[model samples]
Target: MSKVSLPRHVHRVVSRGREYFYYQERRGTLHAGERIRLPNDPQTPEFWNAVRQAQGTFGPTPTDTIGALIDAFEVSWATRQRKISKGTQEHYRRYLKPARKAWGDLPARELRPRHVDALIRKIGADKPGAANNILDALKAMVSWANGPVELLTHDPTQGVERFSKGEGHRPWTSQQLAFAEQVFTGTIRRFFFLSRYTGQRISDVVRLSPNDVDDGGFSLPQKKTGVKPWCPIFPELEAEMVTWERRPGPYLLQSSGKSAGKPFSTNQMWKAFDRERKKYSVLSGAVPHGLRANAVIRLRGEGYTALQISDMVGMSVEMVESYSRHADRKASGQAVLREFQERDASQIVKRLESGKRK
Candidate 1:
């Protein structure tokens, strides 16, 4: 039953199957909220352009449909996937899943700042870290949706402070590291050693090879950033990693002839790493990712600066900001300062004694 009815507004976006419907009201056109149907045929990309065009013409988009906004966000996200990494794409997808309205559609032009704030608050109540992750993703959507509007304009997630640190990385203790090293060998060693050395993501480590490791240094592109770059290996791990062969197909670390040739799925490698990590001590608390943080900790303790560590580990200063945030960093800092201060005091006392003797 296709009944011609004007619920409200000058233009209406009805997403029924492929054809989108929109009403038009222009200069020398009818009154405010006069019904006009614009083309939404998928064949004509102008249909999308027309909708984008309409916003510039109007003062404020009428209290638009919330359902329509959610759909628009999905479309914008798909467009962005062309330029970003797969990891980022998956992250945005997770955020978009919860952003759907109760009716399964949200209009872009109708969202208010309060709506975003409330969503952030609700997510925060559920889990603080997740709340921030979702907020970042939601903000990307808000930015796209704000292209139009004359007045009553407010961007959501604006002025909304993001969540700060909670707990820090749970790196393995020296004993745990020793114990794991003693018990593990072969392919497991390759995986474990790379984690200890390169501070690479598990996905990157498993895919690493002799070609990636050269002259006691390993270099590869980050799967997450899609950046092709190289990072040096820890001297201790480098000696072993440099000898491995680069396979034509998948992994650097191999189990046997068959599984060795193909790459391990992310989940598969995670499960395998978990088994190895748990074997030493439950207290090690080192996940596949925790190993990367541990490497950073070791590097910093050995007098590496943030920039040096970022370059060596193939991360941005911003992304590796988490690395500098260990609870022990402050404690470690104080200890180093105290040691130097005591050394200075001792030297001063020695000079005074020598002067008195003279």
Candidate 2:
């Protein structure tokens, strides 16, 4: 069998021509734990659970420490008590690492807003986005710690500010979209249309299957938010679908590679989309995620309210409003222009009436 990548602290040994995996703490480490046998298949969830168990037994951690709180929160996530999508869990883990490294041993009650602020500033000096993510992760962990169990006395992340950043994922312009219609074809074109019409995140879009569609429309339980919204089959999307050859699995599949015919992973889809996007100067600023905002803007232009857009797209009304900012501004400007025009026209009519009276 081919070699498999193993998680940290895990080791593989070949004994009597049989492969076995074990989780062994480093011999020289201060808190060396006993060697525990792990499952043969690392891909299974059981294997991960075993790994978690092994890590848990490594040493005693103070219940009040930040590290203990972090571990508890992670367990909650893994056990689905504080349910979050896998993608979100991964994102949180990435940011939580710095906190775990820096302040894991510190008492949770002792963490202050100043410490949080200082960390943010230190990280913000280099990567503002990462700093903001770290702050978000810290806020979430601190909030959970202060819940019914009350691991913390006060919120350390309270009054801590996120680093200011540009409005993320700029929406594609009509001109750029029009340019895409001429240049883009096949899977890339289909991806553009699905993202442009559904207003779903790329994560959900890649997982979209023919099985999800019904008479009403596509019944999608959104991955990130878990909102099961029925996205209507717009005529534009339907037109594109009619041309597509039916497939057994997902609507979108990898056309070529060792993974060909399998559904595209989110990263793979983004890279493929990006490669196509880079071919034209007009599309340089455009991205796959921007198509979601593009869809929201189009819906707003068609007179859909924020609540209506929220229902259709499974996004919070606040997010719908955020994405529709440009559309809202345009609508507001038009309303103001119409008011001025109507006032001018009314005055003109009054003047004509006065001339007639004279």
Candidate 3:
């Protein structure tokens, strides 16, 4: 085969009587030893476009800046591979946006622990949880850069401590549930019942289908965890869905209107739920997500072990225990109060006997 002279950073090789072009980055870590095949003839627009994509130059050049690293990471995951959920990808973008404005142009290799410390302090002042989440996002990107992308030899966000936030999502009380139930009816009521009974997230609940139900139980793979939760359909949940007059279309919680029977989009459903919730005088600090905590707490109170709750809820044992912490504390306090009551009763009995003898 005759050697074809190619452009710098572009290599040509022939196999099976066809010519192929591959573009490699001359300087970038990800570029080193990586060959990205071009689509067609070198002179065509498609070929250059393919080369640009392979080089990852369609967006900001991911060469040196921390901002570019974030861009590259977004391109790789959000646009190209899409390995994470849309919500998670949006979260990453939200966290990275301010970071990009602050330090995007800074060299990733030059970032030090002190820089991370300063960033954390600055972000933590306004919102501690957000600061922690920012660090987590940066840490994840840095790790990806160091490993797969090969853009960095070292992680910049290493050893950055997460801000101490209290336990997440306060458990919903029975009174709160009752008030919300009284306020919500039909579709919203059914949705709330599904969430509480199944201990699933709102995202999963909105996506539930009739096919997700079975003869004995409700079974479906959770969106965030990918764990298939097979929960025995609670009697209340069964009755709630069975009695509904409107036929369910795509989702179990089908909305009525022009799109009748179709499932509610996550945002549309959440916004609607929120608007109605604000209308009613619901419990403070209670959210739809807290319903999951309520379920976990109720199950724990009913003598279900942490492990059992974890299995039913498709959560880790640690998470189940965490959600049950308030319930556990209440139980413990009651037990201690019982001990004092018993002691006081015995003292009363002794007093009564002495008085009778006198």
Highest lDDT model number = 2
The full ranking of all candidates by lDDT, starting with the best, is 2, 3, 1
Q: Candidate 1 — number of clashing residue pairs?
A: 14
Two-way TM-score contest, 2 vs 3, winner: 2
Screening candidate 3 with a backbone cut-off below 3 angstroms (N, C-alpha, C), the clashing residue pairs are: 67-104
Instruction: Put down candidate 2 lDDT per residue, 112-172, tens digits, no spaces.
Output: 8998899899999999989999999998878777786566778899898987765767898
The lDDT for every candidate, in the order shown, is: 0.63, 0.82, 0.75
Worst 10 residues of 2 by lDDT: 41-50
lDDT of 2 at 258: 93
Q: What TM-score would each prediction reach against the true structure?
A: 0.68, 0.79, 0.75
The list of candidate 3 runs beyond 4 A from truth reads: 1-62, 74-87, 245-259, 354-358
Could you tell me the TM-score of candidate 1?
0.68
Give RMSD to native, each candidate: 11.3, 7.4, 8.6
Per-residue lDDT of candidate 3, residues 1-358 (tens digit): 3233345688776789888777876735754867787755553334544655676667533347776567567655533333565666777889888788888668878888788888888989888989988888888788777875588898667677888867888767778888867777877787788888888888788887777876767788877656777777888778776776644443444466687666787777777778777776656667878888988998899999998888888888988988888889999999999999999898889988889632
